[model samples]
Target: MINGAHVILYSHDAEADRAFLRDVLGQPHVDAGGGWLIVKLPPAEIAVHPTDAAQAHELYFLCDDVEGTVRELTARGVEFTEPVTDAGWGLLTRLRLPGGGEVGLYEARHQRATDL
Candidate 1:
């Protein structure tokens, strides 16, 4: 019965961030009135990780090639906040959004739910 999921990224400068998502990342979106854009992300997967400190949720964009994706995004003016590192489960990196928030990007080495 489950249909879909909606993810929210809180931002400081939402207009600028929205522009980046639309222009730089090229995320296809629809305006939900008053210029509020709702982005359509690529196929998604979810995982639950156990933590002892606190509970939190994070979002990451999956790719087939982290290095290549990074290269393409870099050419489009995306700023990577960290170098890509092999995280055992994937090759991982973080990219800075126009609003100063960071999101993880990875090429998964493990099974992905999207394959289902």
Candidate 2:
């Protein structure tokens, strides 16, 4: 039986990014060793989208209210690389991580697998 998923984010500035997630985003984490913080993610689900392009994996944080979440994060000094747009499946945005990586944030219109 599967217990959980661990996601790894490669960062140019690992220390800064860890601080961002721990302080700015207020994610609960524990130091793995020597200040390698492992942040705890919220409830998650996986999906497979058929694409003709190269195979890749994407991660997104789901929210109940995209607008409210955006406002909250913005006030916390988080920079959004993209404005919220209706992506058919959800209201979507991209927030820039301190490591120069962008991750998706969205409120899904489609049924969520997390409910299962």
Candidate 3:
């Protein structure tokens, strides 16, 4: 059985990336003495997407408040690719990071308590 999933992003700029993951992304994470940080991301939806990375795809944040999260990130200087919009089944928001990387935040139309 799978206990859970933990994602550790690789970055040449460790400090900046650490801060970005901690301060910018707002995930509850902890930095231990081993020069690694552990971020507790909410459970993901495992959706399909096209990406050019070594891995097939990336993690998508399944949020309950896409609008509020966007507001917070925008207030903190994160650039957004699009405002929260209805996608018929859910709400979607895309954010542009400091290194031109982007992450998608989503809220499902169907109501369900998240396991975060």
Task: Give the candidate number with the greatest TM-score.
Answer: 1
Query: Which tens-of-lDDT digit does each residue in 1-116 have in candidate 1?
Result: 98899999999999988999889989999999999999989999888889998899998999999999999999998999999999898999999999999999999999989988
Q: What's each prediction's TM-score?
A: 0.96, 0.95, 0.72
Relative to the true structure, how large is the alpha-carbon lDDT of every model? 0.94, 0.93, 0.72
lDDT of 3 at 102: 67
Task: Write down the lDDT that model 2 would get.
Answer: 0.93
Evaluate residue 58 in candidate 2 and report its C-alpha lDDT on the 0 to 100 scale: 84
Candidates ranked, most accurate by lDDT first: 1, 2, 3
Off by over 4 Å in 2: none
Model 2 lDDT tens row, 1-116: 99999999888988988999899888999998999899999889998899999999888999999999999999999999999999898999999989898889999999998888
Tell me which residue pairs clash in candidate 1.
Answer: none
> C-alpha displacement of 52 in model 3, angstroms?
15
Worst 10 residues of 3 by lDDT: 42-51
